[model samples]
Target: MCRWLAYLGEPLRPSTIVLDANNSIVAQSLDSSLGAETVNGDGFGFGWYPTDAPAGTEPALFHSTEPAWNDQNLRELTRAILSPLFFTHVRAAAAPPIQQTNCHPFRYENWMFMHNGAIGGWHKVKRDLTLAIDPSLYPNVLGTTDSEVLFHLALTLGLADDPVAAVGRAIRTVESVGHEHDVQFPWQGTIAVSDGQRVWAFRYSSQGRTRSLFHSADVPTLREMYPDAERLRLFGDEAHLVVSEPLSEMPGVWVEVPESTAAILEPGGYRHEPFLAD
Candidate 1:
């Protein structure tokens, strides 16, 4: 449905992955090889934590209804800013209207969230899901997309306490509500969330067949595998990325995240754990 990526590691310009890579996120916005829609031109969003900001500072965000490939400001901003952690998402609007509020990389305080899938039969269960959000947090819901609702739902269910469990609970809520409306496969998405420190990405769906998700291999390992590759020299050993699709065609560069799994990227490296497990 959409293409997105999350980066955590050394501080570097956002453009390195968003624009300068072989098949950058901007390129995916216009011609995604694996997305359900080839052109995700409805809108785009970028969020990043400033390298110099104090700990727990909120990440800055830039959103536009313009196509990612055609946005001049996006080009300039990504080039100028360097961040240790960031998120970029290009939207392919399904049933929602094309507007800035609906863009991805949705934020709440110091946290950022984005998604690359949809809730089946969203209209049938929209009311129930929205009403389930905690009233205190409900006021912060600024968009109509199921993605934003899912974020707030996670927050209400305790995203601040435990992201993995909160997200699991949120998806379960969506599945439960959708089942009441006869929508068989209610939840489908590869979601990424961060609290300005570590990133937690989940790949899951109610039907068991989920969207594509991958994380980059550790930099030291990549360096040893491809010693002569110039691109490999640019990143620090701590660099890691989790994306909807591989950013490059280099062999051994990206590893496919398993179905029903949560890939967590932290300072040292990354790891995978079963998500929504019984």
Candidate 2:
């Protein structure tokens, strides 16, 4: 269990959302109204593509085991950095220990991954899932989190070629393995994966109920709805964000992600498609 946000749009400081929003990621770290746990203080991490990088280049990363609010370095990095696409996550420590390596927004080449759910009865299913990962990728795992293992499974299943299919396969395997071990609820909660350009976010669970996730409308639309809200004035038209909860309380500002669906965001716009178990 964790809380995460993915931003894609015109360049802006990370703090604009992480620390400056009405109910910022920092605020959610302490009082996440919709999360299973209110305080995700185990650890935190962030990744952003450098402004100087070539169009297709990868991102730079900074991670720490300290709580987001308790780490001065995060604040320092937040103030000095800006990105059109970035991921920030606060950990609640599900199976994964409180360490820098176990933090979300785990990176591999140009790809970055994070999750807000746990593999049910992980201890029982861990071995089977670990063996499913190609030995080549198995060693890349630096932490014991179910989230990171899931990412490796996706990679082994060809995440770079087709993220949707790769993740779907991984989910299939997770459910398959869990059932063999007599574990229920093999999958749960929301997920986000990106290659520093496009983002794929999914909401799903075995029981047809998933975690709380929402995304903001375009900045122009939000501005019209909250004309007097100063916070809405900071972002450009390209600004878009997918969050675990509404960052602002204003009406018509955020739309909930449908259960059993995946949302994709890119510079062009947003798209939603049904997500089904494999």
Candidate 3:
């Protein structure tokens, strides 16, 4: 499993959540509370949209094969950058070699994606899924992990046109392939994606018990309820985060995403909907 986060709403310091939270992404690298691995040190990556970059400009990215907790460059970079929508992930290699390409938060044009669980029996089902991908997008499959293939499959199905529908179709296809291969519950994970505007997070598994996912309530709601608390000031007005696990122990601050659910986050706020199958 991996530990990841998708942030939207305000463009402040990237490190504000990556390094500032009580149990920050870096902290989770060594002490994740919900991940099966407990320690996610395989590698790490960060993607963020710059405030001044042009519309088609690609988000800035930094990745390393080293454990995130020990990556000096990661520390140097996150603290110095800022963006409205960003994603950070720490990987726990799932039977693959530890390499930069194996890291999460894979990118394609304006899209960035990350996953926290494995595709059951990926080895057995790899052939069918790989052959099912669109050849035009097949070159983008740089890694052997199920995650990269899944991203491209979503891209193939129509992620850019309609993210929710595209992903739903992609997953359904994955399930069909999985069932044919006799790989029960072939899908497992919490997924997060953003195009530098609206961020979408999903919690789903072929089985009912999926990986853990949570999102913070709106900042205004918290500030209104806490009045004079100085802690509220730590997060900017539009600050919001959705993660594989709670970044802190702040009460009334986090809500667990229901199984087979999806959430969209933007400047307006978070909107959640059941992840119904198409």
Candidate 4:
């Protein structure tokens, strides 16, 4: 339903991928070839962990109801800030109202979460799903989007204690509740989450037909392959990215994240594991 991207590794200006990539997240906001909607102009958000911030600090957030391409403030801020990790999403309102709080990259403490799919029959599932969130976290549910609810549910189920397991538990809970309501495939989308130091990206849908998600190859390997590419040469070995769509057409630069899987990004490297509802 939308497009998003995350970056980890070297400290770089957010615009490097959010605005300057060949098919940048800003470009995808207007002309996404793979997203369910071609133009996701309803709203957008940016969350980044400042390079100079103390460890475990929450990311700073910037959101707007304006389209990414039309927001001069976005350009100004992205160009000015340098971050070790960040998230940016351009939204296409599904069943939710067009408001700034409904944007992606929702934050909770040190973690930031974003999604690019809907929970099928959300109106039917919303109440039950929302009631599952931890009472303390319930107040943080400032938005009405299913994506935001999913983040809270995961937190309630233990996202902070163990992200992968908690996400799996949350999805299972969603599926179980959806099935009870006669909705066959309750979960449908990809999710990206991070805690400043590492990121976790997932590709899953009840029907096995999910949106696009890809992560960049190791910087050193990609650098050797495209020695002349300035973008490739500019990054250090620890740089890594996970995006809703390929940022460029460069072969071997990006690898599609496997279906039904979660890919983890860290300064050391990347890892993939099957993502199941149960």
Candidate number achieving the greatest TM-score relative to the actual structure: 1
1 versus 4: better lDDT goes to:
1
Top lDDT prediction, candidate number: 1
lDDT of 2 by residue, 86-201 (tens): 99999898666688889888888899898998898899999889988899887789988889999999999999998888888898899899989888788887889988788999
The lDDT per prediction is: 0.94, 0.87, 0.85, 0.92
Between candidates 2 and 4, the TM-score winner: 4
How do all models score by TM-score? 0.99, 0.96, 0.96, 0.98
User: Model 4 RMSD to the real structure?
Assistant: 1.0
Clash count, one per candidate? 0, 0, 0, 0
Q: Per-residue lDDT for 37-79 in model 3, tens only?
A: 8999898998888976666666777889898889888878887
Across residues 8-79, which tens digit of lDDT does each residue of candidate 4 receive? 988998888888888999999999999899999999999999896776899999999999999999999999
The TM-score of predicted model 2 comes to: 0.96
Off by over 4 Å in 3: none
For candidate 1, which ten residues in a row score worst on lDDT? 52-61
Better of 2 and 3 by lDDT: 2
What's the CA error at residue 256 for candidate 4, in Å? 0.5
User: lDDT score, residue 176, model 2?
Assistant: 90
Which residue pairs clash within candidate 1?
none
CA shift of 183, model 3, Å: 0.9
